[model samples]
Target: MARTRIIEIDPLTRVEGHGKVTIHLDDHNNVDEARLHIVEFRGFERFILGRLYWEVPVIVQRLCGICPVSHHLAASKAMDSIVGVDCLTPTAEKMRRLMHYGQIMQSNVLHFFHLSSPDLLFGFESEVEKRNIFGIIEAYPELAVKGIKMRKFGQEVIRATAGKKIHGTSAIPGGVNKNLSLAERDHLLQDIEQMIEWAQEAVAIAEGYCVDHLSLVQQFATFNSSHMSLVREDGAMDLYHGVLRAIDASGNVIFDQVDYRDFNDYLMEEVRSWSYMKFPFIKRRGNLDGWYRVGPLSRMNTAGFIDTPLADDAHQAFRAFAGGRPNQMSLAYHWARMIEVLHCVEKIRQLLHDPDLQGSDLLLRGERREEGIGVLEAPRGTLFHHYRVDNNDQVTFCNLIVATTNNNEAMNRAITQVAKAHLSSQKTIPEGMLNKIEVAVRAYDPCLSCATHALGRMPLDVALYDAAGNLLEHRVKDGR
Candidate 1:
């Protein structure tokens, strides 16, 4: 009889919050199963009840410090429909778009340079202590400086558009609370050219990295799945606003121009015993057959074209590597992320030139409706915020499908694939093999804090089971 063993990685390092990986081995030491588990829970949906509709935007922004602007704007958009406005003032719309672009720029750079770059710059098997931003700075000081300055420029843009960078109160029901002043606009423009140059360079570096590691990019947690994102009427990528679009693994359009309110018609959520995060799937395909992905890779695959000229050219080069198929390579997420950062820089420059950004018509007063649904493409992916109000304008029901939750099923599937590829039939699992599994999870850039919405301290615990379902090993990390 063959002996069985298990491998567990607790509190996946360099991620946003607490999560774990558990790989079960069979009698033959073959990989039996793998799971990515979210261990925390936050009941934001239940706690928001009885609050005023307008307060929802402010309260929900506390979901995650990294992407608070996404929740802030998504909640504000939902409240806008409740207040009976179909469209915001020209200035309000432009200002909100600017703020959103800044959020995306900063977020993309943070992930590419601070969180994920270590894996790319240093070998995946490099020393854990040395695989970090400081290491990158020591080796390539110029590139590190550029990334820092680029992120700083994005944060400054956010501060200029909104009152502050994180948890800003600029977006409100029906419109924004403030507009961008002429001086503020001019100040932001000062670094636009340099930001664009840095973004373009980043894209080239990412593309080169993908090319250099072509084999790893092709095989690392790569599999076929459906892709989803919001797109303009012409099928151009629109991060701030658009209709929902989904495509299958073969690049066939599954659905297009979907309204946010009618999302229930095509999407459904499944609760898993192993995870606090809900798995979302396409209703038409059912649970097992309906798993889809969101975020940079999904967004790049679903859209027909990027509107910005420079980014559009870069996008074409990105597609050429896939040979006209949906880019299913999971590692290419880094490439897609850099492309998005380029698009955000170009979009920000264009919006800064618009005179409407300086207009004084900031707010619109209106009556309340019984319900409202707000949807927008966040830095991670599509984010949904729905709310129902009582006669007194108090919230009665709230539902939020965060970006990380939408990709939960896909992430688990990817983890299983990585475990099978690297750990199956192995008598001794190396630390590098475990790091590869974490790399699969990191590729998705999941935000567990936002996905679980949990309060209090978070801890990650991973337990491995033998073929007889006996706990063989356990690893735990206290996130507090």
Candidate 2:
């Protein structure tokens, strides 16, 4: 008889914030099950009740240091809709899209190279002694340097748009808080040209590694799941804006225009007894049931056309994965991210060079009611922010549906697969497996802090439970 083995990872780090994962194994050294759990969300949704409408942008943006802009936009878009300020003008729309692209470009680079690359680049079975950022830098200096450049480029875009590298004061309820000058636009253009050159090299670096290490994609790409993203009617990806659409691996459109308010349609959220975060699923069609994958992988699958050259080439390469159509693969997230980054750089270059970008077409505007929804293609996946206003138009409610939340199903399953495959036989799994599971979560670049504080916060202890009613784990965290 095989004895039961349990290996758990707590407090996933090295990206945005904290998370946890646990896996179970059988005596035969096979993974029996896997669970991805997140502890310590202070119920931000409950906390955001009763605040001014205009404050929604500022308050929601505080959800996470790394992804404040997403929150800011989600809330702003929702609020704009509520107040009927639909005419945000083309220039404002272009600028916002430009900034949104930057978020995707930078965050994807960080996840693949800094967080997930360690295990793939250095064999997962290799000694843990030399599998960190410093080690990667020492051994693969070019890749490491590319990672740095990509990250810096992202931050620079954020700084130029929102006035802060991490969080920005602009992107308010109705309109942006600031405008740009011709010189500033010129500078942004120049920077984008340089970044595009660098991105070309970065792409080569990834392709080289990926080609030489086909096993990385082959192994990690196991398992197929449904994909989802926001897109225009013509099936082009709409990063900063659009309606939600989900597509299956067989090139079938599973769902479309899922009303932001009716997200409950074709989607369901199930609470795991072991974690505070809720797992989401596609309202299964027949036997194709259960939660689905989101973020970069999903976005690429859902998108039918590529607008940028590099992204288009990558997309074609991806289609070659199966029957000249994109098949489900976890590592496709890396591919999708690079494609998006390419699109972002090229788009930004065009927008910056445009004559309208240099003018002060942008103007600050306030709103009567602040309650709103901000939605954006966060690097990880579809991110949504919803808000409500009180009598005085103060914030009465804030709810966030973040990117990681979108990939909870896939992240949990992938961790379980790895644990089953690699750690089932061991009496005790290495701390590295725990970290690896966490790395899987970060591969989505989830902004946990922002998610927990999305609705609002109150102090609470998170508890995990099993079928027998045993307490598996528990942790406490504060809400901001």
Candidate 3:
């Protein structure tokens, strides 16, 4: 009789929040299918009902601690529309931009150095015990220190602009509540040059890995799909603000410069039976084929160029490496992410020198509207916030498409590609083989709690089964 089995990996490590993956093997032990299942669900949308519209920007920060600022700003932007403010003052806009760039820079640094560095620096199949941030600290102390300082710099920017690190009240309905003072600016400037140098080195590390493991990067979890991001009108990468744009794998524009407020017209979310996370796709292409990728890789694919010189140069080399086509290699996300880190630091340096940041005009006001939509590129990808406020200023409806949720279909595909390539027909499963699966998922840096709109704790269950559906092995992991 032919052998067949089903493998389950619960509570995928290294990514945010709770989730699991299942891989099915056919009669010949060839992989039949793979799925990344999101098990927990929370009623965050419903949780917003009846809350004052003004409270949304603050409350939404509860979504995910990892990228709280993304939610804060996205909700604030939507509330801006609710108040009918189309454009923010120079000071307000610049402050928010600074906060955003800091958020992205620090988050990327944490992911690249503390989270994924162990895998990249020490091979994905290396010993699990030593394949962690602590391991990096032990072996590469200087690199570890740099990562910590880089992240601290980003957090400090957030503190200056947002008023505090975790969840801040700086951003209000129409604009920011605070601006950077001279002292704050001077403090940030002290580390600006060093941060830039460290960011550039980080990019080199990622690029070196890709170049050294060209074959592995080319084959492992790599596939061509549509890419999407927010780009400046002239097609430069603008992480804080811009119109939505998506391109096919060949670099053909799928949709260009569409206002994110009308995103419902161009995109639709499909609810799958097994996963709580919704699969979002472009409406014109339909659900099956319209699923596109977002985040650093997609940003690199869609942006015409990086506006900053150092980042632009790095971007140019990255593009040339892909022969001027969309880089579909999944592992290349590390390289692209580092490039964004460089861009963020450069923008921070520029913003710190701008005198407008010290301006007193921090807020704006206008006629109120009942409904509003706001979208921005978060650290992971594009984040959308929509709300309907009652006449009493209470939120009547709410919907959010978190960045990680936007990459839902893409992460599943990546996991499947890795599973098939690494686990198919294997007589015995090794921890290293499983780590490869996680490396693929981690490439996208999914935030499951943010995606599923859930909070609180949940247990994890890992199970293995025979072809006939008999459970062969099972393990449980208690929730924290």
Candidate 4:
């Protein structure tokens, strides 16, 4: 009889939050199953219950430190609906857009430069100690410096609009709290051109890597799947606000321009016994086969065109390279991400020159409502925020379907594909082969802490094992 064994990478590195990957090998050494498990959980939805409706916008920011602005804005937009405001003032909308674009630009830069660049620049199987952001700083100092400055510029934009870098109370129900001053606009303008130039360079690097390594990019953790995102009324890429859109692998529309308020009618969340995170799928397509991907890759596939000039050209080239079909390569996410960065910088420049951002009309209000829903394209993907308020001004219900949760199933599939491709039929799994599995998960850029919505306490455990199936070290920490 052949022996069966399991390999686990607990507390996965480089990605946000706490999670692990488990790979099961059959008796013949062929891969049987692989799963990306969320070992940690945070109850932000439960925590928000009973709080005043107005405070939820600021409280939701605690869901993620890296993309707090996304949660903050999404919650605020929902509250806008609760207050019965269908549209915001010109100054208010523009200010919020500026804040959102800054958030996306900075978040994407951090992921590409610090988190995923090491694997892309150096080979995925490179030495563990050397394959990191520090190594990039040591070898490519100029590129590293540019990444820092670009991120700094984006943060500065946030500070000017949102009042702080981490969590600001700028966005409120129906509108924003402050408008951009002339000094802030001038300061941001000074660095806008350089930011655009650097963003372009980043896109070229990602694009070149994919073109040069076509075979690897095509087959590595890649499969034909459905994609979803938000798009402008005219079918342009609009991250801050738009109706819902989903497309299949062949680039055909599954759904388009559906109001986000009725998300319940189309989307369903499936809970499995094995995972703390929930898998979301289209209700019409059935839970099993309706699973789709979100984030930069899906956004690229769903967006009909980019409104900006330079980014539009880049988008056209990217689509042409895929023969006008949805690009299914997981590795191409970096390229699509950089294109978004470029588009953000372009939008920032245009917003700074506009006089509406400096207008005094900041707040608007109308008839009140009990329930509201808001959806936006976050740095990771589509984010949904829904809330119901009681007459006492207290929150009665809260439900959040974050970007990471939307991609949970897709990430697991990617890990399974990579593990089977690289580790099957091997006598012993090398550390490098393990890194390949990580590469696949990292492509999704999942936020485990945000996706995990399980309540109560759970214990944590850590174990180190040698190639000979012997435990080298074991540790466990009790959870409250």
Candidate 5:
């Protein structure tokens, strides 16, 4: 009789979600199947149903520490649409874009150096402790310092442009609450320059990895579908807000730019019973064939071209690998992240230089309650926050579409692929492969807190079983 094997991760820690992964393998080295599950339900929608209109941003920003800007922008956006007024003037619009650029820079850099770099530079066999950002502190301190400085400088811009570092209250229904003082502007520019230098060094280091590890790229870059992102009809990178456009896997442009109302017509969410997260794909293409990815690579693929100069250069380098198509391998996320970092710096510099950004009045105060939706390119991907308010300015409906939700189908497919590739009979059942599969999902850097808002912590029970259904191992995880 051949031995049966199962790998289970119950209640994954150090990240969002009561998440788990299960892998089952048959005797004779055949891999049967795998699943990625998101447990627990918090009715964030129900919690906000009766709240005041302006309280939306305040309430939703607490969804996740990693992508609070996404929630804040989305919630506020829904209000903007509902009220039927685009409150921000040219200056306010510029400032909001700058704030959002800072968010994109910090978030993309965090994923690059902290989460994904360890797997790229150090062998997966490297000690788990030494395989994180701290590992870089031990083995390659200068590179690690560059990463830290990059993140800090980007966050400093965020703090100065907005109010708080993580959860900020500057964005409002009509406009922003904060103004850009002269001193703060100078401080922001200085930080932007420093961020530029640090990002350049980080890019060089990543390029080294790209050059040295061809095989890793080959396995990690497998593309399953085409890509999508928000951009202008003229083909410029639209950061703060724009229409959504996507291309099929064959490189044919599907829809150049589609407005949000038509969002459901072109792209729709596929409800899956296995996970709370919904898979987003082009409506007509169907599920298995249509699931496209977002975040770094997809954003790079979908945009007609990048606007900023240095970012354009980096983008040129990225295109040299595989031009105008999805790189597919999750490792390519770094290349996309670096391109965006450069893009953020250059565009922010342009925005600051604009005369409008220096004006005194920052907001246009007014209240008009109507159905509205605000769509912006969150650091991870396109974020949609829709809201409906009654005549009394009370919120009645709220719907949020986050970036992670865009990649749900792909993540499941990836888990199963990783299982088949590495969990066969001849392969060793390593202790941390479950975490590795989960890490693949984290490559998208999901913000779970933004998905919902009600409060409930649930316990976890992970059970391993053989093909015949006999129990092999069981473990329970502590709930919050």
Candidate 6:
């Protein structure tokens, strides 16, 4: 009889938060199951109850250091509903969009140059010690410098529009607490051309990588799944505001311009025994077949066109690379991300040039309502924040469906695909092989810290079971 075994990569590196990979092998050494498990839990949804509704935007921003601006905006948008405001003031909306675009630019640049570029630039099989941002700096110092400068520009834009770089309490229920000054606008304008140039260069770099490694790009953790994002009524991409849209694997739009307040009408979250992260899927399709993807790749596939000129051109080129179909190759996320970064830059320029950006009309007063729902396209993907307020404007219930949670099932399926293709009967696994598996998870660029919101460090454990379900070997790593 063939022997059964399991392989696990504890404490997945180069990604945010605590996670691990587990692959179960059958008696014939065939892959039985693979899962990407999130092992931490933070009770943000439960604990936030009883707080004032106005406090939510500030509190939810604490969910993630990397993309707090996303939470801030989403929660603020929801709170806007609680205050009975259907629309924010023109200036308030413009400032918020500027800040949101800044978050996207910073996040996409960080992911591409700092996290994923190391693998693409250095090769997945390179020496572990040298396959990081530091390695990239050592080899291509100019590129590293450009990335740093672009990220700094994004942060500066955030600082100028919001009060601070991280967790800025500028966005409030009725509107923003601040407005852009001509000086601040001028400061950002000075860097707009530079940021745009760098974004274009980044796109070219990613496209070259996709072409040079066409086979690996196509094969790496590839799967057919539905994509979801926020889009304008005319099908243009809108990160800060729009209706939710979902498209099938064949690129057919299943739903478009659906109000996020009724998310439950189409989307549902499922709990799994193995992880704290919830799996989200389409309600009508059921869990097994309803799983869909969000984030850079999904946004690119679902968006009809980007409003910015340069980004729209890049989008067309990227679609051509996939032969005008929805891109299923997981590695294409990097390409999509670069296009997003370019869009952010161009959009930032347009916003900065608007005369309304300098207007003093930042806040709108309104009476309190009992329920509110907010949704926005975060740097990673679509983020939803729903809250119900009591008569006193205190929060009664809160629910958050973050971007990473939306992609949970897709990440698992991607890992399984990578494991089965690379780990077949290999008596011993190399660090490179393990890195490939991690690469699949990284393609989604998951923010586990935001996904689970756990406080204490969580250790990672892996175990092998025999055909009879008896544990044979185990490994553990303490998280720092």
lDDT of each: 0.87, 0.66, 0.90, 0.88, 0.71, 0.88
**Backbone clash count for every predicted candidate, in the order shown:** 3, 24, 0, 0, 14, 1
TM accuracy, model 2: 0.87
Candidate RMSDs in Å, in order, are 1.9, 4.6, 1.6, 3.2, 3.0, 1.8
Off by over 4 Å in 6: 1-3, 456-480
Per-residue error for 247 in candidate 4, Å, reads 0.7
lDDT per residue (tens digit) for residues 1-480 in model 4: 655556666656777777777777777778877888886677888889999999999999888877889999999999999999989999999999999999999999998998899999999999877788899999899999999899999899899999998898899999999999999999999999999899999999999999999999999999989999999988999999999999988988999999999889989999988788999999999999999999999988999899999999999988987888999999989899999999999999999999999999999998999998989999899999999999998999999999999999899999899989998987665667777887898888877777785322323234434445766444443332
lDDT of 6 by residue, 14-119 (tens): 7778888889887776777789888778889998999988889999899998899999999999999999887999999999999999999998899888888889
Clashing pairs in 3: none
Answer with 2 or 6, whichever has the higher lDDT.
6
lDDT, candidate 2, 340-440, per-residue tens: 77778888777777666545656434445544566778877888776767667666666677788877777777877666656666544455555555545
Model 1, residue pairs in steric clash: 41-454, 42-453, 42-454
Candidate 6 TM-score, true structure as reference: 0.96
Candidate number with greatest TM-score: 3
Q: Residue pairs in steric clash, candidate 6?
A: 42-453
Error of 1 at 316 (Å): 0.8
Give the Å shift of residue 144 in candidate 5: 1.8
TM-score of each: 0.96, 0.87, 0.97, 0.95, 0.91, 0.96
Tens digits of per-residue lDDT, candidate 5, 1-480, equal 775666566664334445666777777656677766666556666778988988889888777676677788777766766555565687767777878888888888887777677766776556666666778778888878877778887787778777888988888876677767778788777766777777776666666676677686667526567678788767777777777888877668887768865676777777777667677778788876777877777887777678887887777777667754556767676777778888888887887677776776766655575687777788777777777788888888877777767766666677777767765664554545544664565566654444433233323345667767787777655544
Worst 10 residues of 4 by lDDT: 454-463
- For 1-480, candidate 3 gives per-residue lDDT tens digits of 765687887767787888888888887777887888888888789989999988999998888887889999999999999999989999999999999999999999999998899999899999988988999999999999999999999999999999988898899999998889999999999999999999999999999999999999999889999999999989999997899999999999999988888999998999999999999999999999999999999999999999999999999999988999999998999999999999999999999999999999989999999999989999899999989999999999999888988899988889889888888878666778778888998999888899997654433445678878898876544444
Question: Which residue runs of candidate 2 sit more than 4 Å off their true CA positions?
Answer: 1-3, 27-29, 257-262, 284-290, 363-371, 428-439, 453-480
